[model samples]
Target: MVLPALMLFVAVVLIPLAMTVLLSFNDWGQYKGIEQVFILKNWREIWEDDYFLEMFLRTFRIAVLATLITALLGAPEAYILNRMQGRWKGFFLLVILGPLLISVVARTLGWALLFGGANGVVNKALMSLGVIGAPIPFMFTETGVVVALAHVMMPFMVLSVWAALQRVDPQIENAAMSLGAGHATILRRIVLPQIMPGILSGAIIVFSLSASAFATPSIIGGRRLKVAATLAYDEFLNTLNWPLGAAVAVLLLVALVLIVVGSNALIERRYAEVFR
Candidate 1:
């Protein structure tokens, strides 16, 4: 049973990935079929272009910031939820999980309205508060992009962090308290250390998701900030450059692989240290 499923997964995921790697090295353009010989132009071009580096830097920065900010926001929420019992717990889970069920298009549209220029709720509220003399630049800027991406990626981090938090035996906390540890000391010495793995796992998910996100950044970033995913989308879909686009896709995939592998190793090391 599992063999068939595993085979199917390999067929779908690994096969395309292998195909993309082959495509990235070839110049399969509109003028040519898969007949073209392999070339390093795509990789070379990406490396030489300063703007490309900026786009990648911006993307990396945005993803990092969004993951950190959302983790901060979600960790407390997850902790609170994990502590609760009964109907309230289920209801709260429903609330957190509700957004996952909603279409990404729908969520993006909602944020667009709030962040719309001038008459928008966000701009209007800020203006009323006299925080700025003019509507602060948003909806196409890095700040707006980060804000939107954080909301979209929050749930993954929250659940992971919560699971980590819940796994820390209650006895450890009680023992900390019994040993004359302050609230802050208990949190720092015991609770925080135990939950570190969960937080790292959440950050890994959040980072990967945001890094690969195209829609939210496209709609909310509004063409101003181009993340790596959108660049691939434009190259493959818009320009009909399969080879170049596939190359970009492969790049994104490689980045994801590296981050996940490195982060998991770090998590494992921390787990060993903490458990030892």
Candidate 2:
């Protein structure tokens, strides 16, 4: 039974990945196009270039900030949603997930309109509320990309925590309350510990997705700000540098794999007793 699935995985995922990695070692020139020769030119260029360094830094920075925002906000929202009863819960859940129902491109374009220059809707609203003295730049900025990504990735965090909440025993909270434990104490000791795995899982999901995201970052960051995904896109499509693009892509894959593996190992170690 597992053999077929393993074969499918190798065929669909491993084969393509291996091909791309090999391609990254090939040579490419403007006039010569792609040459099937094994060399470190693409990898060496990425390693030595400050532009690639800054772009990768920007990519992870946005991903980290977006992950933090989702964890901070989504965890609490999940708790609240879990506590609610009846039809209202479903209605609110739908509202939370409404963004996922829409097309990513459409949602990003909507953000672009709201973030339109100094006279954008978001800026005007903030100005009217006296939140700032002047218009803040949202279009073609890292700030805009982070905000949009947080919104896009929020549902995954909420759903993960909500699933964890299901495994929690409600009687534990009541029992603690009857034993003279304060609400804060009960929450801090009992609730948060139980839900920690969920939060970590959600963080991993949001971080990985944000790091590799193309559409939202492309639309909001625009030409001014370029992350790894957009940079890879430009290399392949715009610059016609297939080997270089493949190198960027492989580097991104390696980085995410390391991060995800490290995170999973830490979570398993920390929560080993709890899970067992």
Candidate 3:
């Protein structure tokens, strides 16, 4: 049973991945078919391009910031949710998950409307309250992209941390509280360690999703901001540079893999050091 599933997975994922790796090495200048003349030109050129580097760095920064924001927002919510009971729990859970049901494009478009200049709802409300004389720049900005990505990724972080919190024994917290342990101490020493795995998982998912996101960034960030994903889109679709686009895609994939693996390793190392 597992063998068939594994084979199917390899066929769908690994095969394309292998092809992408191969494509990244070849130069396909104005050619439609797969180029046989393989070289290091594509990777070398992309690596040296300042614009490409800027886009990659921006993508990385956005992903990290979004993941951190999600964690900060989600962690406390998860802790609170774990303490809740009955109908309220389910209702709140549904609320957190409500955005997931909406299409990504639709969600992004909604944000675009809210972040629109001058007459936008958010700007209008803020202006009415005398918060600002003029609308703050959001549309086509990095801040706009990060805000929307965080909103989209928050649910995953919340659910992951919530699941982790569920596994924690409440009696342990009760015992700590009875022993006169401060809330901060209990949270730092007990709650955080147990939920670290969940945070790590959530961070990985959020970071990967945000880094690869095209629709939200493209729509919200507009042409002014260019992340690695958008650059890849332009290279492949707009410029028709398949090899270069493939190289960019490979680099993005490698970056995600490193982030995931590096996070796991760091967590494991910290756990060992703390325990030892």
Best by TM-score: 2
Model 1 segments more than 4 A misplaced? 28-35, 129-134
Cα lDDT of all candidates, in order?
0.85, 0.95, 0.91
Superposed Cα deviation of residue 155, candidate 3 (Å): 0.7
Q: What's the distance in Å from true for residue 186, model 1?
A: 2.5
After superposing candidate 3, which stretches have Cα over 4 Å from the reference? 31-34, 127-133
Q: Write down the TM-score of every candidate.
A: 0.91, 0.96, 0.93
As for lDDT, the candidate ahead, 1 or 2, is 2
> Candidate 3 residues 1-276, lDDT tens each?
699999999999999999988988876766565575779998889878788888988998999999999999999999999888999999999999999999999999999989888788888998999999988888988888999999988999999999999899999999999999999999999899999989988888999999999999999998789898888888888888888899999999998899889988998898899889
Ranking by lDDT: 2, 3, 1
TM-score of model number 3: 0.93
In terms of lDDT, the poorest run of 10 residues in model 2 is 267-276
lDDT of 3 at 169: 96
In order of listing, the candidates' clash counts read 0, 0, 0
Task: Give the worst 10-residue stretch by lDDT in candidate 3.
Answer: 27-36
Clashing pairs in 1: none
lDDT of 2 by residue, 196-250 (tens): 8899999999999999999999999998899999999999999999999999999
Model 1 shows how many backbone clashes?
A: 0
